[model samples]
Structures are given as structure tokens and as C-alpha cells.
Target chain A: MQQIINFIIRNKNFLLFLLLFLLALVFTIQSHSYHKSKFVNSANFVSGGVYNSVNNISEYLHLKSQNQLLTEENNRLRNLLFNSNVNADSTFIDTTKFGLAYKFYSASIIKNSYTTKDNILLINKGEKDSIKQDYGVISSKGVIGIIDKTSNRFATVISILNTTNKISAQLKKSNHFGTLTWNGQNPATVQLIDIPVNAKVTVGDTIITSGRSSIFPKNIGIGVVKDFEKDVAENFYEINISLFNDMTNLEHVYIIENVHKQEINNLLDE
Target chain B: MNSSLILNISRFIMLVLAQVIIFNNVNFYGYINPYIYILFIAFFPVRDNRLTLIFVSFLIGLTIDMFLDSGGMHAAASVFIAYMRPLLLRWSFGTLYEHQTIRFTTIDFGPKISYLILLTFAHHLVLFTLEFFSISKTILILQKTLFCGIFTVILSIILSIIFSRKTK
Candidate 1:
């Protein structure tokens, strides 16, 4: 027993170093790669709840400012569509035969993260507000994200700027379509791939959502071409686009529910 | 003994709470996260085992990581600093640190200041490198580390002095 005790005492420092080094190695391996443990879901749920509560407090403080901004925006839009001299045909027509095609619900972003590869935004509106998975979300400037998950009072939106997110986009003038992706390099910029080299390109060309998908309406403003380069394949031109709305700065957004989404999905299922 | 232990626990809890709740969220234009939590590890009584000190640091860091949902970034960095601490002490004070317990204020100002600088640098290096794990953007990593490190190091040094003065 004495010898065993002495042995443990003598080897204690080495053992401690070994233990710490191993712990560090384990943490480094887990963090430096994408292999985050599955158990993190519980942590996310817990922290997410805390984050939600704190966000609610901050959002409450900002309610007056938010209301003021909304009022100003409402006035601007009202002046745009209901301009007193506008022709009746140009105005929003009440087609009695048409269904409620699009429903918009105002939502406040309760939690936001942009640094992760799969960034998600949690909003205050959810199932109770008719916010469902796959519903589209946008700020005043442009497209923000699509709903990925929902609870009774909260829904998570996978932002277009997320590394895993790809949406159909195109050059505004030419209508030549491409896929928009975040290169994970900068938040201000996103990459557009699959634009054929044959199409004319310039540094300042504007890009817009193609509306190829049923999620978003056509010609929504995305970004302007900040730079352009040829891809490794050389057959296509890859365009670097600078986004219009700063995704990090978003607060309140509109959740879009396409009335025809189910029909479109059913058709695509075939 | 019981009251001191409770006092230490409350102090540590308060430090962690303030650091995470206030400092971490304040971007200061994405340039600062004043990590005052290290002061808890720094001011731990001299008699505690080195291994225990390291373990405590790990626990603290892991708690922060859990809140941030950062997996283990803080834990890794904290452990790295903990591992290097003994070597840093030995180098800074030669054999004095090994033979005697360190009281920061009573120690010669030279050794104490140097000790603070070295440890602060070591901690910041590990934290920033782990936070930015990829070498693909080494320049950005360096920029962030240097800017945040300078501000945080200054704050930590000032806090340490205040702490030591009060205790004295």
C-alpha cells in the first residue's frame, strides 16, 4: 500500500498533464471540426430558451422605436401603392374569385446567430401565428430566410446567408439564373454560381431572386455584383454579390405564407 | 472556512455571470469580450493543487461554452492556459515561485507585471486561436486576437491591481 501511494504521488504531475492534454485534445478535435456531439441539442434548447427570454426583454425596450419605424414604413408603402393619381388597374385588385394568395404576419427575431455554418434565426411568431416550416421570411429590403422549425410561439428560420442555404437567384437585367451561396468568408458578400460564361457580366450588375421556387416572389432584390471570376471548371462564371440588407442587423421581418404553397408542393411531388 | 468557501463560490459565480451576460454580448463593434472570469482562477488560494486549478478553469470555461453553444472552444483555450501556467511561473520567477507561494502585490513589481502580461497573452492566444480554428484566414485571426487581447489584457491587469490592493 505504501509503494502504491508513493507511485501515485510520483506520477501525479505526469498524470495531471496527460489528463489536461487529453481533455484539450478532445475539445480541439470536437470544435475544430463539424462533429459537434448530438447531445448539444439539449444545450441548444436550454440556452435557446434563456436567449429567448433575454431577447424578449430587449425587444420590449425597443417596442416604441419598432412601432415608429413600422409606421414610417407603412406610410411609405401606402404612398407607393395608393398614390392618389394611380390608375385603378395598377392598384391591388379585389378579385372575388381569387383566394387569399399570400398572408404576411409580422414577427420579431428573438434569437439570432450568424457565425455558424447552419445559422438559424428564431422568431416570435409560430404555429399560433400560422408560421409553419417552409414559410418564407423577408425584411423590408429583401429575402431573409425560410422557416425550418416551429413551436407554439417560436419558429426558426434558416437564413439565406447560411452556409447550408442555397436559393435560386438571377441577374436582374438578363434573367440568367444561378444559385446563391454563402462562401463563409464575409457576411456582406454571397457567391452566385452556375451563371453561364456566355452571359454578359459587369461589376455593378444587380442580382435578384429568380422566383424559380414557389417560396419567394419573383425579382426580389438580393445584391449587386461586387466582383466576378471564372470558376475552376471554367465553363461558368462565379459572381461575387454584396447583399443589400445586412442580415446581422435584422430585427422585425415579415413571414410570408403562400396560399398556393401546398398546391405547388403537391405538383412537385409528382 | 465555510464562510470563506461560500464567499469564493459566490464571487466566482458573480464574475462568470457578469462576464457572460454583459461582456460577451457587447461586441464593441465586434472587437471586445472582456473575460473577467479568469480573475476567479487567478485569485484562487495558493494551497490548491495545480491539477485542481486546471480542473476549475476547465469547468468554468465549459460552463461558458454551454451558454454560447460554442461546443468546447472556451474549454480548450482555458485548459491550454492552465497547462502552460506552471511553466510560465517557473520561467518568470526562477526557483522562488516553486519554493514559496505567490502573493501578487507583495511580489516584486517586475515579476508580478511580467507574470500578468505573459499569462494574459497566453490566455488570449489560446482563446482567439480556438475561437478561430481555421488557418485559412490567419490574418483576420491575428487582427482579432491582437485588438481584443490588448484591451482585455489592460482591463485584467487593472482589475488584478485593484483586487490585490483591496486584499492588502
Candidate 2:
């Protein structure tokens, strides 16, 4: 006991400094914006590089499953190319037939965060690759997010799972449009608001982007209606949609840029 | 002796007030920010309790950080210099540090300049590095550290000389 007290007295300054230093460090990290911290940037660089290498290895490991998926996609494309001509009235609207109003840019998701109220996904493409804010991003399965911000070599996306994100969507069966939003509770489920009570909606009905906004083209698959209930106003239906893409497992994504966005926006302004 | 302690405490408050309210707003160049508030940690009485010195330095730094919203950079740098003051004083003033309080006014001309410059430089370097927290902007970091250090060193020396007690 005597020795411990002597030691404390002897090096009290160092101990005090250490304690205060830790408090200051915690304050620093807690107060600093995640993007503002150069620590986060360097950490992103290091982690991005590591994830790239790990993805490369895992890509090799999952070759069989990936190849099967690719083959299935290829077969679907071939079918579309051949049968699309004969069955012009098919439910699927081949994008190639839609002129040059929309362009698709391929990007790989480097970081995905779905556990927060305002979750964001970081992609490898950025402004240098012609990506801009408000660009709609989707995977082969379904819609993922919209581009929020871009640096030189990277872009961040506001994911569909985010509470603040609202995408315009409609039912494929009834064509009744509503505002899609996330409840921040389930990654697999999102809610559609302002759907009029009169709309004929049933469980498992397909939901898709309405093309009302210039962000996404019409008929982009969103999900299936899982459940719905009357809102507080008793006029609109609060629909629950089960997302098709497992947001947590996304690896590759396609950014959709509507080239006519500005022209349409300008017309609306007038 | 009690008067001197009161004077030191008052000086600490005055310097912190000046730093946050006045000097912090003086953004001369794009990157150069003069941290003259570190004067409190730089010239604290040498024979004072080391633990008290560190705690006091922390309080001063924390006060400045709260005003500036700088996320504890000032506090971290202040504690660092407070801890290093003893070793730096022994290095700069040799035996003089062992016998007497390191008041800027009573110190010799040569040792005073060395002590002021070294501590000012150390404080500025740590402050800027923590504020930036990145190694990629090496040139920008060095540019900021050197310019701010030079500006702070000049201001601190001039202020200390002006405030130094007259020797008989």
C-alpha cells in the first residue's frame, strides 16, 4: 500500500495527463464528423484496399455460384434478344428499345452500411466516372440506392434502407403509385406511404419504380407488397414491401443516369 | 508567493480569453493560425506541482476547444506540452531549471529564446497534425505546422518580453 501510494505521488503528472488525453481523444472522435476526420479517409483507403484483395480471393472462391448466376443472366438476355422481337407485348420492357434517354454505368460497392437510420453505401466509381448525385443505383436483382455524393474516386449512396430516402414506386398490377420509405427496423422490409385506400393491392403484388421522377426510369423492379394497413388519416395505405436485393450481401451495382433529367427538370421549373 | 500564484492564475484566464476570443479569429493567411494561447502551458512556473500544471493546462485547452469547436485538438496538444515541459526545460536551461522557477522575464536571453521556440514548435506541430489527422497531405501539413509555429513563436516571445518582470 505504501509503495503504491509513493508510486502514485511520484508519477502523478503522467497519470493525470494520460487520463485527460484519453478524454480528449474520445471527445475528438465523438465530435468530429466521420467524413471530416482524415483518420476515416486513411482508414477507408486501407480498408478499401484490403477489401478489394479479399473480394478478389472470394470472387475466385465463389466462381461456381457466380458463373451460374452469370449464365442464367446470359440465358435471359439471349431469350430477350430472340423472343423480344416476336413477343413485343411481353411484360418486360427491354431497355435497349428505350432509345438513349438512360445510360447505365457499372460500379462495385466497396462499403455497405445498413444498420443506421441514415445508412449509406460507398461505391468504387465517382465523378470521374460520370456519376453524379441523385443517380439511381440497382443490382441485377433490384433497386439498391441513389447516389448522394461523389469524390474523385469514390461515391456514397443513400440506400433504400435509410429512413430519409423516399423513392417513387407503384404497384405493377394496379399502377397505383406511392412514396417508398424505410422504417429503420428491418433491412428486408420497407414501407410505402400515401397509397390511396381505393387502390386494389394484394399480398405478393409486384412493386416497381413509377418513373414519375427523373431519378429512375419507369418499371424498375422494387419489391413485392408483403403487408399493409390504414394510416392515421384512414385514407392512404401504409404498405410494407419486402426488398428483392439482400442489401447486406450486395457486391456489384449499376448506376442509372437519366440523361434527360435536366431537360425535364427545366420544363418543370417553367 | 501567494501574489505570484494569483498572478499566474489570472494570466492563465486572460490568455485563454484572448486566445479564443481574439487570436482565434486572426486568420492571416489561408492556413496559418496563431495559437498564442499555448503561452499558458509554455511559461507555467517550473517548481509548481507537475500534476496541477497538467490539469490546469488541460482546463485551459478544453476551454479554448469548447469555444472554437475544434474537437479537443487544443486540449490534447496542451497536455502533451505540459508533460514535456520539465524535460524540455532541463534540456534548454541545464542546471538553471533545477534551481529556479522558469519565468520568462527572469530567464536569460539565450535560454529563453531556445525554450520558447522549442515548446512553441512542439505544440504547433502536435496541434496541426491532430487537427488534420492525415498523412496524405504531407506538404500541406508541414506548411501549416511551420507557418503557424513561426507566427506563434514570434507572438509569444514578444508578449513574454513585454510582460517579463523587471530584475533589480
Candidate 1 interface CA RMSD, Å: 3.5
As a whole number from 0 to 100, the lDDT of residue A186 in candidate 1 is: 71
lDDT against the true structure, each candidate: 0.73, 0.76
Mark the 10 consecutive residues where model 1 chain B has the least summed lDDT: B64-73
User: What does the lDDT read for residue B73 in candidate 2?
Assistant: 76
- Per-model clash counts, in order, read 0, 0
In the range A1-270, model 1's lDDT, one tens digit per residue, is 999999989877656756765675566455434324422211245545666777867777767866876787788789988877757767677588578777888987876666544456667776878788777898877789888756677676777756667789999889789998886657778899999999999999999989888888787788899999999989899999988877766688998888898899899999
Model number with the top lDDT: 2
**Runs in model 2 with CA error above 4 Å?**
A1-54, A61-65, A86-99, B1-168
Error of 2 at A51 (Å): 4.5
TM-score of 2: 0.51
**Per-residue lDDT tens digits of candidate 2, residues A1-270?**
999999998878788999998887766664444333322221133334543554565556556755665687679789889976576576987778776999999988765555434566668887789898889999877899888657676777778976668889999987789999986657889999999999998899999999999999998888998999999989999999999887766777899999999999999999
Query: After superposing the true interface residues, what Cα RMSD does each candidate give?
Result: 3.5, 12.8
Docking class of 1: acceptable
DockQ of 2: 0.16
